[model samples]
Target: MDTQGIFDSSSTVRDCSTIFALSTLLSSVQIYNLKENVKEDDLQHLQLFTEYGKQLKKDNGKKPFQVLEFVIRDWQYDYDYAYGQSGGEELLAKRLEITEGMATELRELRQHIRSCFERVTCFLMPHPGFEVRKKSFAGEISKLDEEFKTALKELVPSILAPANLTPKLINGGRVTARDLFTYFKTYMTIFNSNTMPPIESIMKATSEAALLAAMQVARELYETRMARVTAGLSLPRPALQQEHVAALQAARAACIDKNKMASTKDVNESLARLTQELEALLPQYLLINDGNLQKALGEAKDAYEASVRRVHGADLLCVHPSDLQTIHNEAVAAALRVFDARRKQYPGIPDDNRTKLLESFLPRLDELNTLNNEHNRLFVADAKLSFMGEVERLLARDPPLGPYEFRNEYNRAKNRAVAAFKRRRNMPSTYYADVYEDDLLRSIENRYYIIREINRNT
Candidate 1:
């Protein structure tokens, strides 16, 4: 027997020696007729004994006997299975090739092939049931001749339509640069492989197509938003607030960053240009609406009024009654004129310019009010001393006036001084009424002594 030849031919069938030995042992059991319907348990017991007999023969140095025993056992096993079956010869021929080792190898090979098909389908095709459809197409091609197989490979590009290659948003709606790069890298690998050239081209083309599609979609969305913002800008002041402008700016920045990963210059440049246009329009569209403008103006007016009130309150502590009133009126009138003019000017004012004007005007108004109040306070303090001196001078007359007339004159002058003091101090009319009467009596008595002295000296 050409044992070496047999082993080489059935290399996939490992442990062929066992099969050979088992076959020889089964052939020695010739008592079991090939045509007889034998019980399965009896055959099983007989096979076990055959193995024992083969081992014994091998131990006795009858190696040739062992080979013959294996061949006989194999033949009998085949005969028993094929007996009384349809197409027995064909069945035996097919079953003979399927050893335990060959079956295991075939199963493993099937699993590996399935994995490869799945990876190709997911990475390149990326559609529903694409693997199954591809497998079916492959089956059909395999049934055809060698020429048809060659043509299939050449015609695959036309036969298999490219999947819709729109970029998908992974991990929510945020598509990062990493996500896009990963997809691009996967397709690139397929493109560089030795697989079907048509499929590789499809993968490369789809990757590009998807990126472009994503850019277009993003462009349209951003453009629509920018259009709405521009339309809003066309309206009168107070229409757009700071938040609206901020949102537009954020959207523009996001669009730029998202599209920056695109492979093509045109896509990047186009997105950048759109963003630039949006940025340019941003200033123009940032018109403040009437409500927002009024709100800001109201705040400024409130601040101005509060400042004026504070200045007036501080001035009242020391300002001359007359000068304090004058300063207060002027400050109020000036603030009103400025605020009114601002309100009127707001009709056609750009938001930026309006903000600049307000920034300049409000702080100046506050400072002016503060300075004027200080000036009035100093003036009033000086005036109080001057009025006191004037009263004392009037009471020291050399020529004595009549008693009633002197009393009346002194009372009038004292009342006038009291009124001035009350006005300067921001006090009510009744605040020093009692004190004024007492001071008047005292002044009259003092005037009597002075008049008496003057008469005696004369």
Candidate 2:
């Protein structure tokens, strides 16, 4: 059932038509009741509404109106006129024909309604009690004549026959129940104002609202996942990177899946906004990874120092140079391991962060090795000086002895110096120690010879 034409002089009729217009915004299938035949006034009113719908479609993306069915009621009363004795395509064509000049207005109206609503169907319905009046009425529908009961049954299914009963769509997204409230409120406000708002205003407001809702959903999911992934702010680079990737995938899927029934264009737009939001989040992760990696490098350096101290005491260069090299190698290896363990792996992110940090640390290890070399040189020098001092003290005498006695004194002093050098804990290699000892003894022997020459002259 519907209202009279919007142009009706009756204020109540116009008001009712306005209400009908509001219903059109939400309608998927509209059933128009006809007394016996299609009237020119009825077509004119429907055409006016169809024009309004077209305006809506122009302003918005698409129309919600899908099916329009005209039911000719009590058609059994005029069976010959209604069926035209053929009751097939011939009847329908003859009824809808506009060959007469009196129906010029109706021709235009029918054309307009057809353009607005693509799926148009008409059904001939008889009075429900007409069968009972014949005293042949049965309780069940199968007992009744196929006219009234069958027509009702067929009308219901036909109205619902569309494979997909699509809902209203704005922009590209499907209008949700929450959106319906806003839509009705907007339309009623304009309607109550006694003026219709422009289509642009309505479309813009509603479309933005729908798009925002979609974007919000995506952002919330993305944020939740990212927050969990970065909560401690200390994830390994690779682990954090993997989590970020997973978060992005899940966010996109959620946005698309949630709005799957929406227009493809609308869904894409929402996804685009989500992409932008994800882009904005990237800088934060970069900073975190950068700081984390630096901290890792520092920890690696500390580990290197600790390992060195644990394996080789403070006197690093006291052993053979090769042994010091071995200690340095072990410490450096341990430090590299520490750095590697701390390094994070980020997918699609550059490996330069880890690579650069590791590279920078290598120079520090080299510097440490140099420091050990210097320490070794000082230890060997100190040992040689102590040995020489001891030999000089042993050989010096107030009265110089003969050559054989001098030789024996020299050998005794030399043996004692060698023993003292060996007793020092932080000594260099034994081969190095022997080389220094021989040089010190040669110098002492010359002094002994001078002493002997002085004794002989006396």
Candidate 3:
């Protein structure tokens, strides 16, 4: 019977005096059911049910029934709208199947209430959108079709009959199984009505959704694979020594292949750019690994130290300008050899390391050049000073000689002083060339004349 027929029959039975108490009890039960069926559906009631359920669980040992009453009251307050205004109450009532009276154990009651809440939530919650579901899968697209079908089954009814669907099934206006089926049938009819057959539109939307989901999966896969490939490319691999460059090239080719198949521009562009960058950097990484760049740097430092020692020990004064020039050239050449050897051995060394290595040796080379110049100046000064001292000593003799004897004594003394001067200054005897010897002779004669004048005055 319909709700109204049941109500009328309950009223008629309530008027009888013979079974008055039982009739009143029956009437009260019917009225309660009717009230529960008539309340409006509100989404907020779900939260209320959850809160009351939690409170009921918490108070299980004390005043459990009171917490249960709160839960039931909250459920009825929100979900009463599930009872149909158009005779679908029977179906909703069957779906709920809630028994009257509380259970003896709070655990049983909690379970029952939780089950009720789950049914209501499942029936009322809107189906996730395509984008939302795609994200929820977290880039795993293997079971996308099955998942989408399940989601459609849950969401399509609401989309088709949103007006009839109620938030709470306990006391709300009910939507029946038959009603949902009928809506689906009608929707299919309209969907297929066009001549061009909006089937393409449906297919396109589905394809786009699948593509979006697949793109997420592809992006994640690409990233993980690229990370592995990048690590392999960046590190030294002795086993793969001969094939390292080829391996990198193959990896880049695979990335390009994946990029070509990418469903989204972002995925395609990202993979393409990553491959390009890896390709650009791979050569340098490989060169460093192959050349053992760190070892080369260590060797260069050793060469620099040896060159510094050689520069420090060399006798700058004894060396001719040409020999000093040769020594300086050799030191520079040795340093350049280190630099060139390192450049050849570890061409991929970063500019910063190269600059530091050059700095270590360049200053020592400049100091060697400066020392050679100073030695040249000192040698010339010592030679002239020795020539003056020898000439003065000869002129200060106890008995003055004639020009002939004086000439012989002066020549002998000049020769001996010149040889001693060369020895004292750490220079070769022949370091004073013919022109230098001529100038020294003229200087000695002029000094001898000055000494003779001093002797005559005495």
Q: Pick the candidate with the highest lDDT.
A: 2
For model 1, how many clashes? 20
Clashing pairs in 2: 172-263, 237-344, 237-345, 238-344, 238-345
Worst 10 residues of 1 by lDDT: 118-127
Clashes of 2: 5
Using all chains and alpha carbons, the TM-scores for the candidates as numbered come to 0.29, 0.46, 0.33
Give each model's whole-structure lDDT: 0.41, 0.61, 0.42
Candidate 1 C-alpha error for residue 98, in Å: 17
- Model 2 over residues 93-141: C-alpha lDDT tens digits? 5655667674666676655566567466667776665456665565666
Output the better candidate (2/3) by lDDT.
2
lDDT by residue (1-458, candidate 1, tens digit) is 12332234554333333333223222211222222223333233233333333333333322212111011111233333431222233432342233466656444433332222111110011112233355556545345544334433433443234642222332113334554454445445434543323422433343354454444445455556645544412333443444345555565555545543334675566557655655565554344334434554565566556655664465544433344445455555555555444453334446553455356655654565465556444444444455456546655667755566656665675556555544554333323334333443455446556654543454
- In model 3, how large is the Cα lDDT of residue 63? 17
For all predictions, the C-alpha RMSD in Å is 25.1, 12.2, 22.3
Worst 10 residues of 3 by lDDT: 64-73
Question: How would you encode candidate 3's per-residue C-alpha lDDT over 333-383 as one tens digit per residue?
Answer: 675566555443223433454556566666765665576456654654677
Candidate 2 has its poorest 10 consecutive residues by lDDT at 82-91
What's model 1's TM-score? 0.29
TM-score-superior candidate, 2 or 3: 2
lDDT for model 2, please.
Answer: 0.61
